[model samples]
Target: MQHSTSRWTMLAGSAAVAAAMFAFPSSAALAANATLPANDHVLRVCADPNYLPYSNRAGQGFENKVAALVAKAMGRKLEYTWASYRGHGGYSNFLAENLDARKCDVVMNLPYGDHEESYTKPYYTSSYVFITRKDTHYHIRSMNSVSMHSIKIGFESDTTPETAIKLLDLINNAVAFHVASNPQASPRELLQAVQDGKVGVMITWEPAIGDFLKDYPDLQVARVPSEEYGPGLPTVGYTYGMSMGVRKGDTALKHALDKVIAREQPEITATLAQYDVKLLPNPRHVNFPNQ
Candidate 1:
């Protein structure tokens, strides 16, 4: 739940909360609204100014690079509408306040399957990964071990790792970090906890922590297996196709954005590689390749 679903929670809280924030017409209606037309001379993007590996005010994240490509291909200049992904507003409805409100026209890292908006074609897909300090030799690639019960692990709530840990009765040895938590960089907080010896392992969406690995050179990563996607109601999967989110029923804009995605895919792939964000090798047969 890093960049994509981490942006969620607000999407998953409850049906009433979800439906209250959107204008998903039974058909196309946004085309009739004049307040936020799509064909403007600028590509207005919504992003977190402090969230690294995704976006920031400095235009240094992979999403920033991808958005630049989209704007360039569309023959428009790029403009950002900054939004904080976390802190202060506890579980803020970022989409309602931004994209749906026309404050911005696109949101990258919107995981596939989000029903609140009409999203563009996926630019890249990333998986959940296991992170451990090299000095500890955690070497854990799967969540099925009996050793799981003995390790102190930090896992995101409402995600595959949480589900697997719960199913195996390993919750006692685990600390849970909510993607919807308040007032701090939750992903970095967890990793810092591990580096400080508060926890020995962490399971999180790779991009959320990938770019920050440079600060903790001793940290190592392994993809959490696909089988850990968990069970029961409201389960998010192991791998997600990352796309761009625009207003619901905004087909004109959606189509325009799709063309950019299809055309600049090679550049997008290269941008992701710059951040150590690998595209999934296989959807169902995901593996933890050596870096």
Candidate 2:
């Protein structure tokens, strides 16, 4: 079953990458899909189209800036392929189509701390916050505060939400409506759940959570401090980074990408800020890594 799913995922990713490349003719061809050498004048990137605050066709998102930054640093141009990030098997599809198929050199805006995808380094760190009813006292300041009241937390599966909640031992608070399937569900779903006395919390990351609050004035998010959770669930931070997702032996490209990131960090952050994307801060550098 796993193998079959994996194969299907690969096909889906490949198709997506192909579609993206076809959509953007200006971009360079990838090694996996067509035949582009590492010495090509342009770098190919695979991104999620509908995902905002990250990458989109408008070219104003953080990931897009990162891509442009790397290109500028390397004195190369950027070509992009877009895909939809639905759920669980997403990276597999992305990897199969983009990396394995060589349609793109890097998958931008991946969660920095995620070990599953072989991340580059810690770039930006954001926090996982929840929106609860203004009237409710379910401040997500700590896990112990999560009482089994009527509070239901909306979490996107197979994401930091899953890991963050698990680390906090707040799995029981999870509301299983499947956001991936019901992409149209409003931010009000969480609010309605709380207002109707269904759930007390709706856990998600930025910038959606931030966007949700903007749209719904009544919905207030819980600003959970990182120290509120246990060690594993330490809310101290979540990272957003970019890395070159190459086939297992694609070390040469990876080395080149790392150098690009180092050189282009400043320009990337400036571009991102233009889109209202505030990257996480670090002691040495304010820019996030992976990209």
Candidate 3:
């Protein structure tokens, strides 16, 4: 449960190793979609085939719906370059396979300000949350509420929640389960642990909790309050802004996407609401890049 390794490193290994190991799809295959009729405008999106609440091959995730909305607003056809980064050793080579190799023009969801690629202005913000059965009545809204010595909490190993638990000295009483240990360790299995009484509570990302709540009304989630980083400054713990990704130096495409995001903001919110995604409030008087 207590491992001294960063989650990002545990998942992606080293950049050099990832580049050397992943076989980039051929240029021909990447450009195949470009040959469509000139009149047919298409937005090629790179996405995972099995990741849920984000994307899947069947286009069921919220990101898929957002992509479709963007395409429609721009009067284009939606196409996907289904890439399985999880299969390549549970790490994502998104920038390489999706953008560098020209497999897709854009990635639907990526952490905003990611240096790996140019990101459009963030459309939404999210954070980690605590999930527990409604009957437990364990009102754990923050790390302060956790009884380090008595209450047992569960979280995906090598995630932000585990890090927070360790920082708060709760690792000994926490159950850290590695999702990569089993490729199928999705939200369903994680929540099932709490439902089966194997774990008292589970700390996971909010998006997954939102999706699961629809089917399991017996479960409830508590949003983690923003942590004070310094005097007069507080930031949401494990929270991040999410945005669409395009290749570096693709300024025109980025600007066009920015316009689309600004114009279709309402539609995007509605789409995310349909999936029960918990949205963070936008900061006031904020300025985004290229704005």
Candidate 4:
């Protein structure tokens, strides 16, 4: 999430290939208990097999459950085409290999707006949070907080949070974490640093924080607020909308997904809750371009 590469990068190979002639406006339009290659009865999902709290080969991630919910709502079978979203080069092959190659109809958990693919309206919103040990003497609600100046901070370098820290003259107090060192283990290592006293506080995106929270009972989390921004920081940008991606012009699937997302929002929220996700308000509205 902290990479310099735009997370909303374009599809490497843009193909307008449509599936069967049929297109459904919503899940109801599809027949129940249908199978693939039979009038598009299956929801082919493209996902990373090991990114937990999100997805994995074992299908234990919330995104997996969300995918099933989508398929069930559409009355179609769920079939997965596993692919790593990241690699030695970092999130480079995701769209080229999967979405562009038509490995799946939709790719889940995209940050909404401005992408090579036509993303469905956001399904949920989350934020970057400030995590600290429970025994810490104070809270860090933003970069300007009093505690932030004295504490050693840990964050993936080159992100806005790092920028904010630098502008605030706290660079000397910062500790950098490399998420790409090990996609599966990086977040854990960051959290572990906070847990083990390597850093007094850590700021991280919400999605990566939940899965490791159970192991760090002493950690306390606070959602960084939008108000945390100043001259250099336009907004704390703690909040962001997350959506699903489909072919660039696949409005058929796009609208259908938007409906399922709205209809199944309750279930989706519950899924995230099961992982102890740090829920924040905002992102119910998407910042899409002119309609």
Query: What is each predicted model's overall lDDT from 0 to 1?
Result: 0.68, 0.51, 0.67, 0.68
What TM-score number comes out for model 3? 0.79
Best by lDDT: 1
Q: Per-residue lDDT tens digits of candidate 2, residues 111-178?
A: 33332344455444444456666766655554346453345666545444445567666677676544
Tell me model 1's lDDT, rounded to 2 decimals.
0.68
Q: What TM-score does each of the candidates earn?
A: 0.81, 0.65, 0.79, 0.81
TM value for model 2: 0.65
| lDDT (tens digit, per residue) of candidate 4 on 34-139 | 2324236888889888877678899998889999999999999999988776554344346555665665778886666634557888777677778899987876
For residue 178, give model 3's deviation from the true position in Å.
3.0
Residues 182-268 of candidate 3 have per-residue lDDT tens digits of: 445566777888888888888776776577677887788877655643466433245656688887887877898999999998889
Question: Which lDDT value does model 3 have at 187?
Answer: 65
Worst 10 residues of 1 by lDDT: 10-19
In model 3, the runs with Cα more than 4 Å from the true position are 1-40, 89-91, 180-182, 228-236, 283-291
Candidate 2 backbone overlaps, count: 18
lDDT of candidate 1 at residue 223, scale 0 to 100: 79
